[model samples]
Target chain A: MTDNQRLYWRATRRLTVGLLLVWFAVSFGAGILFREALDAASIGGAPLGFWMAQQGSIYVFVLLIVIYCTAMTRLERKFGIDQKGSDQ
Target chain B: MSGPLWSWVFVGLTFALYIGIAVWSRAGSTRDFYVAGHDVPPVLNGMATAADWMSAASFLSMAGLIAFLGYGGSVYLMGWTGGYVLLALLLAPYLREFGKFTVPDFVGDRYDSRAARIIAVICALFVSFTYIAGQMKGVGVAFSAFLDVPQNWGIAIGMAIVLVYAVLGGMKGITYTQVAQYVVLIFAYTVPAIFISLAITGQLVPQIGFTSESVLPRLDRLLVELGFTEYTQTTKAKIDVFCITAALMFGTAGLPHVIIRFFTVENAQAARRSAGWALAFIAVLYTTAPAVGAFARINFIDQVNETAIDDLPAWFETWESTGYIDLDDKNGDGVVQYRAGADNEVVPNRDIFVLANPQIAGLPAWVVGLVVAGGMAAALSTAAGLLMVISSAVSHDLMRMTFRPDMTDKQELRWARISAAGAVVAAGLLGIFADNLGFVAQVVAFAFGLAAASLFPVIVLGIFWGRFNKQGAIAAMVTGLVTTFSYIVWFKFVDPDPAGWWLGISPEGIGFAFMWLALAVGVLTAVATPAPPDHIRQLVEDIRIPGAN
Candidate 1:
């Protein structure tokens, strides 16, 4: 791989892996694993973990995708690869 | 107009509108039929994908499941929606960059093996056919309950509507039609939710009402008093919940109908944005659904518990007539009781909660009609989307790629239409005979597990691991299908009990265990075997970036 493409790929991988960890924490972690512990607190009127499991995690999923798109766009611009032509 | 009359009016108008859209968007070429010529806007494609993904199960049955499952129901909420995160970040953009018409196209090319492609075709067909049968049944249920159409006749009508568009317009037609359907089904879901939320908690948004201070505490206490688990408490094994949600998330990301929608967009950039929009559109219903469940449950219990038969609300008899909700008055006190034990005099089927939610809350006649129309929109749009996948799997993947490499585009289009029509007839028969088959819900849910286990691992590894060769791909698919399919049949059909659950994983959750197994097997086999050819590695590298050189 070219150095330029490798740099861009590394940054993209870091971003994806980090965001995926957050996704896991919310849905699988807070939503399921730590749910009982989190239930000691509440959000609005819902038990904290219960809300995360059913409602909060879904909202976060939406946000994470938005962030991924925005961040990827910035990466493309930084790498100067945002043009419309194909390598082939 | 009265309730039934309003139903007729809405169904008539929506059906007319869908048919009109199908006519205008009819596909003239294989590109138009397969991927809408790859010019769809991100937001529009997102909406269409949402409509395709939501299905009759999401629109008609989800809230009812949530109503009963309570806190335990987060598996559907989190598992299904969370998959999109994986799609947007890891899969959709990359697959969109690959610029394929079908998932199997990518598999066949990436692995450079027709055998791999045919296996993918089988996986796609299995999931789509199983999934479509339930949708046709959902269509039938709404038609019979709301429009007074006989069940068989209802399936026939639903099949015909799907056939007109899916066979005629193909992906292009299903796209715009699904966009329209998304609007209808979302309105149908949220309007009733808003009404119930307002009536129950004086809140406009059901999600907020469900979260903010409301009637849930009293509902929980009353449920416990009636010998039930707490409403917001986990009643199932936590591991079962965990595994089921994982399987569903992986399955959703892997679903062919959903994956193919990305190729309808212009580029990978649009694919990412579309995934976001799809989730946002889906969240409209998913976030509101739990609230609908809580509200519907509270309303249902209040209306039935200790109410004398003579004084029972009108909806009681109405729903009872449909056999969705029944009152036996078993104690002979002429009063109905809905408790957890055998003494309970009410059988509130899941359908009654969602399908009957509007009437249960004393909504207007027009609202009931609107909900029925919404249910039909949800059912048919998904049916059409699945039909697209089924037809393309047979025509594009099986016919052109494998058997008839020299086939003309014109012949391919004709065959595509033929396959779609055949699928609609088969799906209709499944729906018409769903009762004797008697496992619609079980089979539809099992599709998720099947997709998760068989297709998800190979596709994900195909993109990320350049060395994932055809041998590894074939091994993964065979292992995933055999393990997941046989395990589900063994547990769900042969001996249905928790005693047989492996490590607290239910049949639906078996996919979670097997997905990881498929991934490991694929990776290990790829390493142990020869690496892929130079071109396949290069294809993988090229798909990772837009302006690769």
Candidate 2:
């Protein structure tokens, strides 16, 4: 593979792994591991840990996808791999 | 109008509309049949995927399951939706760049081996069939409860309606029809939820209404008073919750029907955006599900707890006639004390909660009918998608690619239709005979577990890891499939509780263990074996480089 291509691949992998860590934290972390601690706090009248497990994590997941989409679009442009082949 | 008549009108109208769509969008070629001619826009594809992915289990059963399981049910909420992130980022775009008609097509070409393709086909067929069986049973439950049709007849009617669209238009018809079904099912799901939420908490949005101070603490106290666990407290073991959630997330990514929905879009970028759209659409129902669960549980307890059995509401009587909810005077006190124990007199089927919620809440007859129609839409749309995947596995992967290399596109399309019809019949039979298997939700979980263990690792590694060869891919698929399937069958059907389970992971959560096993075998085999052929390496590079197409 060319150096540019290899660089693009590496950057993509780094971005994906980073985003995945966030995903894991919101779900497996707040929702599961630290659920008891969060439950002691409250959100919108329900326990925060319960809300995170049931609702908050899902909202975070949707946000994570949106972030990944926007970030990837920008990365593709920076790497000159965008569908239009222009920085814009 | 009577409830059954109203249900018929709504269900019949929806069925007619689906048939109209089938006739209008019938497939004309192999490409049209398989991938909707690869011309569907991202937003429409997203809607279609949402409908296709949200099966009867999601619409009719999940909220009921959640309502009963309380906080433990977050596994379904998180596991099912969280996988979209994996699909959008790790799998969908690269597979779209590969630009294949089916998932097995990607596997076959990636490994450059027909054997790999066939194994993938077997895995896809197994998952789709098991998944479709749950959809068919969902159809049966909805029909029997709402329309008063016998369970077998419900399965047959659902099979016939699905046969019309899926056989005629193939993926093209299924795609457009699914978009319509999504609108119907989501509206049907949220309207009743909104009504219940407003009644209970005076909040318009069910998502917030559920968490709002209006109802939860009271319900949690009531549950405790009734000797039940707190509604919002953690009830399941954390390890089990973690493993099951992981299994579901990975399993969702591996589902062939969902993956194939991405292929209908135009490009990798559209595929990425479409995944986002699909998740947004799915979130509409998923976020509402918890609220529905909470409201329904509260409503159920409010109406039934400490009430005389004979004086129970008409909805209870109706649900009892369907054998879903039973009232027995176990203590001979003649009052229903709804509590969690074998001695408890009231037994409510988890599947009945969602369908019965409208009636329990005293909603209008039309709303109840709409809920019925929505349940049917969810079941039929998902069944159509699964049948399509099974058909393509048979016609494209097994027949044309493996057996008849010289088959024309016309012949292949004919075979695809035949296979779809055959699959519907097989699924219908399975639905009828496998009534004892488990609830719709449990059966679908098995499908997800199998998919997560078998197809997920291979597909993810094929796109990302350049050194993953055919041997490693096959070994991973086989080991994952065998271990997961054997564990589930042994625990579920054979032993009912095997002492051999590691860390006390139930059959529903065991797939994640096998997934790791597959990953280890795959990496080890890849390292030990020679690298894959150079052409395969170039193909991997091509798929990785965005816009290469």
Candidate 3:
């Protein structure tokens, strides 16, 4: 693997980890732990905490995956690792 | 005669449509059977995966669980959907690029050991069987409730339908049928919710309706006045909640049925795209669930308390007489008061809250029929998906790979169909055996814990750590299996009830904790051992490359 390849992989790793962190925070963080604090805040007449636990976190999760997918396809193209059969 | 007849008509029509699709799209070759010939468009795959992922538990049990547990139940809603983030980002792409048939194929090829694949086969079977038990019985319940038939007969009918499509079509057929199921289920799920939301908050959307202004100011004030939490209030134990959420998150990424959906797509990028699409599709349902749960809880309490019990609406009287809803005037007050905590006197059956919500909230009968149809779709789609995977594992992984390497592709396809029929029969038997089991949610959680404990760690280590060998994967799987299984068995049978248990946490919640511990120990043993051979390294490289021909 060359420098370009290494850079590509590193970028991919960061993007993956970043998405996972948000996934953890929204679901385990806002949805579960801080739900009461969130309840104090309001969204569309519903408490923020209640909304996050049920709906908001899930919406964020879908967005996170779409973001990751967009980021990875770019990374794959940059590293010349775009889907292709190995020349074995 | 009214509701049950409509349910049968809707359910029966939906089943016929699925059978029609399966017959039309049945796979011809081994590749077609295995990966749907890798031609499935991303959007179609997304719909199929949604149906495959949403199971009886998600459809029949999740909102009911949330209705009871309040904020704690968000773990399931978030955890299950959030898992696709992991799948889209890390797992699906590489696995699709690897282009093999099953997860065990990835394990076996990556580790360059037949032993690794064998271990995976065991884990998949274990997970599938546990999952199937709950789903099969769910079919029985739905049948008994909506069709006015015996539970055993219901299971037999469901088993027959699944066997027909799963055996005839394989992955290709199952994929298209799953898409049809997704449409039926989503329509079924949202229609009643819309009516319930309108009735409760005058908001069209359930999510918005949950937070909208209440019809009765006094009722809202009463909730706050009586030390009862507000309808929108969120409350949960944080740390234990964290563990439960994490287990579900990882468990979702680890489920075989969900992962195999990616295999049906054309490329790694499409796999990732499809994962995103799946999350979006799944989110629509997940978000609606809490609103439905919250609104249903509020509406139910109000109805039971204020409606003078005798004139408690036609739906209630109907379900009550049918033994579905049991309402007791404990204090002779003739009103139902629903408060949090175990000590709360009024305890509505959790299952009835969501299933009967359409009727409970005065929705149209047609809408109620749709909800029943939706629940059946969820149960049937998932059951078929599980059956396909189990059968493929038997025919492809076990027989073709190990016993008869020279077997023709034609021979393999035939065996695959046979295996599917056999698996359906076996699952039907298990359903009959566990018919009188406890809550649906509890049984499903046990299966998730089993997947988390037995498969997640082994697969993760094998993919990322070069030192992970066949022995390590095998040992980890076995350790996780034994620990998780025994803990559940002990809690269910030997240990005292939840209140008497060590932590006051129930068996359903505690079983996964034991599984994680076993996974940790097993992975460590693998790390302390030797590296796999060059072929294993090659396999890893193969999976990593975008185009590996």
Candidate 4:
């Protein structure tokens, strides 16, 4: 309900939506739907689509998570909400 | 050392290591038992999570499945790993903020309803037990192939090992043991893969070998020459692939065992960091798996085709006796003929190739021994994690949350251990008879869909949507379960008709559609119903902030 909380939530939604779209595009779009079309091209002697499905997509997924983790951590710090309270 | 000797040595050493770790970090309290006292460092927790997540199936069978299915296997590769993104971004931080012992704890409190918690417990139990049975079966199969033991004996030994660690050490023992298991299993997986890759393509890294011209193009040409689908050709329908991948993604994020690992971390930042590390460690094996699959297929064909029965390797006969390799000379020919069609005389059980890969490539006996230990590690670690979830669901959710509110930590800790022991024994029995009970295999895959349809959407709603009341939560679970459960049972058992599949989406892919369907139904029902109580809304808002601590 506070302005700061509202702003943080909105920022999170923006980051999540943007990242999810990239996730969808890499895994679903190139990996499956447009696979045949992309297969005409190649990566490291493997077809791009096949590479995307088996190797490239997985690599990208990890990168996305790392990016999200760092960005989210920064976002937390920006809002002055980053805390490391000890557990009971 | 000889073959069995090497196997025994590696297996003995790993078993001793696990038991030693368990004894060193024994759980003394309920907190230590459940979430390892919430003091685990992020990177170490990540290693433990990686071990807990990659089961016997991933260790033994995923590469084999990829080999046979070719490009169609993309669904699994994308499905399993992609979900970690969702977990890190959507679920882990909020759930970690909630800081509970189990998934039901969050559901029960967030919804302010006992019914919601009970349903969550049921869903968690069903998913975990379904998954655990398969892990048990995996343990048996791996042991029989590598150790010359009967499947039942393998299951029993696995049960005893899990009993010592999980029952005594609880999650704390399981956590440290899993870190050790991760190192062993990853070393076991990658060392052989690297050797095979070097032999085949002269590449040190298997991922590079997978994409190299020597492997993919040559493998495709060889397969086409032998009347098989080209190795890289797309076989599955695009829509079905999309559906299965989505279903698995959501299902992985929803998994109670995986989700609970995040709770073991110090804070939300640690949870996010650990998710990244877990996926990185898992990707170490997953990325190598396809390369291993491709190399194994090539090696398998070369070893089988046009070879005389007497000329076949000794390992071939060994695997054949275990029923993993069936080389029936159907045409009464002295030479073995392995092709795509029915006349193909050599039909190796898919998993046999992975086990036989080292031998086929002429690796030393010690490598084979390492693999046996690796497979056992993968199976046992996952089984321990699932057993923890089962015991927690029974003792924490069903007993303390629902009825006995005044139960002390000491008493609950005892119950947790008791239930864990009970679960391992029951799972061992299921493993022994897994083949006869055909539905156990079906239920393994069914676990993901059930989680996808029921718990996944509800948990997401509980954190993100404040007004998602108990009515909507109940409705979503019921509708999700009813729809996904019936569809799987119908297609998998009764009909078995590909043409009759709804939109040609297999039961594996059906979870994809139904996840969204359940989410929509949940949202509509929640909106139509009276809003949830004010404190429940406040609780949602509280967990949304990572700094709430």
Best by lDDT: 1
Better candidate number, 2 or 3, judged by DockQ: 3
lDDT tens per residue, model 4, B286-325? 8999999999989888887889998998878887886778
TM-score of chain A of each: 0.92, 0.88, 0.86, 0.90
Please state the Cα-based DockQ of model 1 relative to the true two-chain complex: 0.69
Ranking by DockQ: 4, 1, 3, 2
lDDT, candidate 2, B196-220, per-residue tens? 9999999899987987876788878
Q: For residues A1-88, could you state the per-residue lDDT of candidate 1 as single tens digits?
A: 7788889989999999999999999999999999999999987778899889999999999999999999999999998776365312
- TM-scores of the models, in the order given: 0.98, 0.97, 0.93, 0.98
- Scored by DockQ, the top model is 4
lDDT of each: 0.90, 0.89, 0.77, 0.89
Stretches of candidate 1 exceeding 4 Å from the true structure:
A86-88
How many backbone collisions does model 2 have? 0
Q: What's model 2's lDDT at A24?
A: 95
Return the clash pairs for model 3, or none: A45-B211, A46-B211, A84-B546, A84-B547, A85-B547, A86-B547, A86-B548, A86-B549
Q: Is the docking of candidate 2 incorrect, acceptable, medium or high quality?
A: medium
Instruction: Give per-residue lDDT, candidate 2, residue B147.
Output: 74
Q: Give the better candidate number (1 or 4) by DockQ.
A: 4
Model 4 CA lDDT for position B539: 83
